[model samples]
Target: MLNTACLRIHISARTTTTSRISKLANSASLNTVAARCSHHAAHYDGPSPTIAIIGSGPAGFYTAQKVMRELKGTKVDMYEQLPVPFGLVRFGVAPDHPEVKNCQDTFGDVAASPEYTFIGNVNLGHDLPLPLLAKHYDAIVFAYGASKDRKLGLEGEYKPHIYSARAFVGWYNGLPEYRNLNPDLTAGDTAVVVGQGNVALDVARTLLSKLEHLKKTDITEYAIQALSQSTIRHVHVVGRRGPMQAAFTIKEVRELLQLDDVNFSPIPDELFPNDLKSLPRPRRRLMELLKKGSPPKEGASKSWSLDFLLSPKSLTWSSSDSDKLEGVLFSKTKLEQADSPESKVTNTDETTLIPTSTLFRSIGYKSEAIPGMQELGADFDDQKGTIRHDGIGRVVSLDTREWDKASLYCSGWVKRGPTGVIASTMTDAFQTAEAIVEDWKKTFDSRRPVRAGWKGVQAEAQALNLSLRPVHWSNWQNIDQVEKAVGVERGKPREKFGNVDDMLKASGASG
Candidate 1:
């Protein structure tokens, strides 16, 4: 459990002293200062530019960081629906892969800055409407990631036992939405995860990790208990295309191969050629792992198998139970060469079936249209399932020759169509900030100063009947302290509060 002593202390009293520096100078210094002043004044004039970033994820924090760094004296506020911050890093990354979550440290640093204010438990389109934010802030950046999952679009895809990789990963990672979602893992010894990607690996690893092994991590108590009772033995990671086309990274594949008691085997040599060419480096490494077999002296309880060049056609039930999944029917496929008929590779479509109880599809992620956004004259691509943006992450109107609106922008998965690692997301955010700065430089005179503080904003929100219980930055530090204390009491890592109410209560928020 997390040590309570290690958690940082929380300070609740607000200080009137201005810790932040003001770049606003008198009009007399306007000779050369006018140019630089013009660039910086858009964010500082009248009331500080009330910029609201709509997510608390990596993209949102990084965007806030870059914007505040570039635009002097900007009162940048970030809103998140979750009680806590660090979206995927806190709730999506595998528990064992703590190193990947170092991004949270960077986010913590950004959140601590006086220039940034975090308002948690505020859903953008719910309690806070996009239109309201548009009217309130000079610029509103939507960094809400793709919260929805992609479907298989296959027969029986909606089978009760068949889960979405997003939900499965969320369940193990203690996402509040899926914390209570404990699927029947003991139904069958064999399991199948459709679609080859890092998400698929994450699902498989969570299903395979021993309860004891997970105890040391920050996995929720409920998740730990549920996984402790899982009876899964074999996990088959199936992909529609050949290994070369799989989306999983080399590092993830290596990690999976390193797991004890998990054995990885590929298709027969006749199915895959020894001289397979033009394969990506990650796929090649996966092939090498397959040939070498399991590592020496590993766990003896569970194993994972890899199947490529197969597409799920149907999900067949073995028993009469409507709530349980039985098996999956698959269609075998072979690679085809684009050049000539006599080429080494030729198209081959063979049919087959694999038996399993659990199935997870990890194809990809898609964004959903926010309510009132379209009503506010926002353009979105229905086919692409993302907001329509220019090359620089500006929301473009169909009638306008270019994006002239100063209030609307985006970052993260929503900006770039749900791809790339956290590092890549940071770079993408900086680019988006650059675009915001350029646009501000072009149109500086129109923006007005914002006059609102935490107290004033809360009072206004209350007047509007909005249940605005914001988890201030210091409040998070309190929750962090209490959670770690609870974890230490239980001799485990941090134990998250099951719901928002508990989190707020722990943070000393008044009823």
Candidate 2:
């Protein structure tokens, strides 16, 4: 979905191991950053520019952190639709992966700054007009990650027993939107996951994992109960291409392979290239693992497989019961170049039907432009499922000049497509933050009025009598304390509130 085309209307516009050490090192330099900001504050006499960030996810916080460090006396107001902050960390991330959420500690540090503000329980496009928000800030940063998932576009996709990977993940992770998903995992022992990404692996792993293991994680109590009754044991992770073209990483594959008592179905040796020794280290290792597979445990009751080169053609329903899913119909595909990772795949005449009652589509995630984006001279590329932007992050539209009005920028999945890991997101956010700081410095003028930031937005909302109760940083801290306390009693990290009302009440913003 990378828009490589140089549009005149433009309106607009990572590594794993070394990444972890760099983040830890970055955390230790907070004091130096603060000292540097103080020096900048002492020398600069211009009016402090206020920025409005449209999300409270990793991207928003990281962008805020960098902007505050680079620009002295800057005020950042981060807005979150949910009462709680930390978008993906709180909801999208798997409950078992607590280490991946260490970024929250950095976000916590950013939230502690006096110049930073968190406005939660506020839906931007619905609760407040986008143009009204724009009037209050010198720049607007859109960091809201993807909210929707890509569909398989096959027939019978909307039928029961079929679920998107995004919805399933949300249901297990306690995201309020999908709290009541309650998928019917007891239908059958076999589940077909249609995708080769890490999310597909996550679904397979969760289905195969013991309920007791999931209980120790922050997965909701209801989810744990539902999983306890899951009859799903054999997961077939299907993909449209060969193993070399899989979107999943070695870490995810290894995790699935290491699941206790869950055996892995060895991939066909023909699927991999003969000259594995010449492949890149990561791919070679992954191919080797797929070839080697996990040892069969004596008590193994569950199993999974990495099924490749099969495109989902349609869903098969039970002959006797039209409502019940029977299996998935897949068309066999042939890769143009078996050795190449980017090989094109073509469907062959042969088709295979894998009998299963459940299916999970794990294709990818998608982002949409917030409502009223047109008012700010921004446009959403519906086809691309992203806010149209210059490759760097500056929002572009045919209606507005490049430098006439308040700057509009985007980051993370909204700026680019929804891809990459947390570390990659951090890097993307930092780049956007740099662009913002540079633009602000170049445009700062004595005659220009200082932005009112949140105060202005509050005044506007009051004038309109919107009856909004914005959740502040202190409120979120109270909510955090409550969640953590509950988690302590539950023997888990944190039991997140699964609905907006509960979250609002906990934050004391129910009014």
Candidate 3:
């Protein structure tokens, strides 16, 4: 029924298609076998590498920046649990310190790369098994920061008025997890912070800062209201060490000493190094500043002190109401060797109690393993509270005692532990990026293409019938614009959305 010429042409086209499919399907028999974008990832013969970065914090962004620069054909897919990016910058950083967040500009530049993909609101372990991601990505970098807080194991730590510094900071910065954390700031006139870290100073400063000053920053409206109604008039930043071994940086200490109407109680001279000149330059300067304590300000109604060489013993409750926190009991401690960071402390026979209605523990942060990490041949250090890794950030396998992947890597707090400021985090992240590049080049095959990262993951998720609502970079920008617009009306730099659902809605993504 068909013309001979037309039938012949159709038959030739079909033959060409069959020949091409057979060639592609059997290409593994030739030279290289690579899988990508299939139910398990399809095989390909190209040479570009694909990478997945599992956090949107400063460390993650910095690592991605370095990797992208070093590997021209590398693709980076960043994952975040929050609808927004800039993990700590947006949540952990104090709102008043906008200068520290300048690094977000660099992150913005990195996100703008065509090879970069921002996958926000998709929790790596919660939304999909971590091992499943390993199938798609040639490498996975864990930068999901410390999500838990360290505890002192003291009695009554979970008492009502006692708060962890992490929660307090999150509450003020509008982190969705703590948005509804309505801390009863009006319940106390005196507060005790049981650590001498920078975070402790931040907490103390926020409680003491003038509302007019706070209003100029992007601190949440909710936090502003709670602080404005606060009855706190005294703060004690206590530590189980001397001023010489204090954890606070000089810049933060200076800020506290300079607050407008706040009175600073002088640190004991005995706690400082006797031969100040013999100390390091930074310590010398800090010691000198401490010695020249802020001149007692006239009409200074509120005050704070750097109480040293004391460990928290227990919380004291009101005699009249067992549930009401009345004060804190602390054991006096003596340093094993004074004026040294490594010095240990021993509890003395003496104990002291300071009456107050509130307490904040600023000890430190703890990083825990995601549920599915072990399935990926990676193990979290239960004792250390970190992912098991080489000092340089290569995730390690306990059984094989080798690089967990030659592929799995880590950066930031998850790699090193929760310490240091953003600058330190950037440096560590760069080191991890370099390690990843080094490992990749060492094991790379010229003929084989890297497995598709997000592309393959998308396919797998679809195949598994999982709904993943990812907020891409463009979506985050829309959310940013909305936040800024709202901030303008409130006369603040940028009022953040304190809830996750609202953040997704603003970004035009369904939560």
Best-matching candidate per TM-score: 2
Cα misplacement distance, residue 458 of candidate 2 (Å): 0.9
- Candidate 2 residues lying further than 4 Å off, grouped into runs, are 1-45, 397-404
Assess candidate 2 and give its lDDT: 0.80
Q: In model 3, state the lDDT of residue 102.
A: 59
lDDT for residue 455 in candidate 2, whole number 0-100: 93
Ranking 1 against 3 by lDDT, winner: 3
lDDT of 2 by residue, 150-269 (tens): 888878889899998889988988889998888999999999999887778778888888888888888888888888898988999999999888878777788898999898887888
lDDT by residue (tens digit), candidate 1, 1-511: 2111111110001001111101212222212221232233244332235577878887798787777767767767888888788887677777777655655665787787787888887776777555655545567777887778878787767767788888877787767788667777878898898877778887888888766778887778887877878888889998766654556655567777777666666456654445544544434565665566555545477788778777777778756676567788888766674122122333246677888878888877777878778755567666566677886778753245233233677887787676665545665677777777766665555434453534455666777888766777888888989988988887766887767778888887554
Per-model TM-score, in order, reads 0.83, 0.91, 0.88
Tens-digit lDDT string for candidate 3 (1-511): 1111110111000011122222333343211111111122233333556888989987798789777766776799999999899987778777777765656777898899999999999987888777788767778899988788878787877878889888999999999999988999877799998888888988999999899999989899999999989999999999988887787766678888999999999987888888989987767998899888899999997899999999988888987888799988889999988978679989998999988899988888778888788888677887667888878888853235332232788998888778765545655787888777766666666544447788888899989988899999999999999999999999998999999888888999754
Give the alpha-carbon lDDT of every model: 0.67, 0.80, 0.79
If the candidates were sorted by their TM-score against the true structure, best first, what order would they fall in? 2, 3, 1
Say which prediction, candidate 2 or candidate 3, comes out ahead on TM-score: 2
Q: Which stretches of candidate 3 lie above 4 Å from their native place?
A: 1-46, 397-406, 446-449
